[model samples]
Target: MILEKKVPELWTHLLMVAFAAVCVYVFLPSLLIIYKIIVTVILIVILSIDLVLIIRKKVNYLKLTRLALVNLSILLIIVCLIFYTTNFLVLTDANSLKSVLGGSTLMGKLLFLLICFLQPIVLPLPEAVTIPAGSAVLGSFNAAYLGYSGTISGIATMFLLARIGG
Candidate 1:
């Protein structure tokens, strides 16, 4: 009797697994690098748990997943645009208005870093913009530090949002 009830849920589980496998495959090189493997595994586990909850009808996983997917899609598009613009700037004039800003004063560099740090959490700017601007103005080490700070800030914001929302 219980087996009869669970059979359909089992099928749903299988389908979700297959769909997730396809998503992982399609995202392979980006997701499969040695450094990223752990993160990828964690994400897969989270998704799997969410799928189980969805199948059990214990949660509104669909709405959550849909929101995540939409946000991810937007981020991807912004990332691509940033990459394209960066490449274009590097390949084309290379001495345009942005390049001029790249050679800003020390105060300017600090200001730019602060903006980059805030933008991710507050404004949602493309990281590529912040990175190149940092590299050009602050050099590689400072740029890396600024980027790390921005990521930390973003993570903190996400945590706060999750805590509040949950």
Candidate 2:
């Protein structure tokens, strides 16, 4: 009975490690496209599994799903607000896109990137808008760098929060 109780925990840890290794390996330039597809598939599979488990009542899946739904709803609302605000600012401001992009200067760009990085961790914002906006405004390389930085930072923040809460 004790062994059975521990098995699930062990399996979860192993799966997490495996996924992390896969992500690390996928970071190589040669694997970029494949990595994207793999990641998407993996996410879908994980979500499907969670939904199945919730339906089966095999775990506290219902509570987890509820939490996830709440978070997603909050994220959507924040994203909408940000989109509207950004559009309004751009429309009201006399500066054109070219001027804003050209005149933002390095510091402005860095500040924008920092906000994008911090949003996921500090706010309930959906990253869809911020990430694409970053790519559009900052270009591909900087967009990737900032996105990765934000992701890592957000993960770290979540880890710390969980630890503290626990």
Highest TM-score model number: 2
Model 2 vs truth, CA RMSD: 17.3
Could you tell me which 10 consecutive residues in candidate 2 have the lowest summed lDDT?
Answer: 91-100
TM-score per candidate, in order? 0.34, 0.36
lDDT of each: 0.57, 0.56
- Candidate 1: which stretches are off by over 4 Å? 1-104
Off by over 4 Å in 2: 1-103
Candidate 2: residue 132 Cα off by (Å): 1.4
Model 2, range 52-83, lDDT digits (tens) per residue? 76456565553454454345445445655675
Residue range 14-87, candidate 1, lDDT tens digits: 45545444444453335446634553564466567666765676554544544544454455456556755664
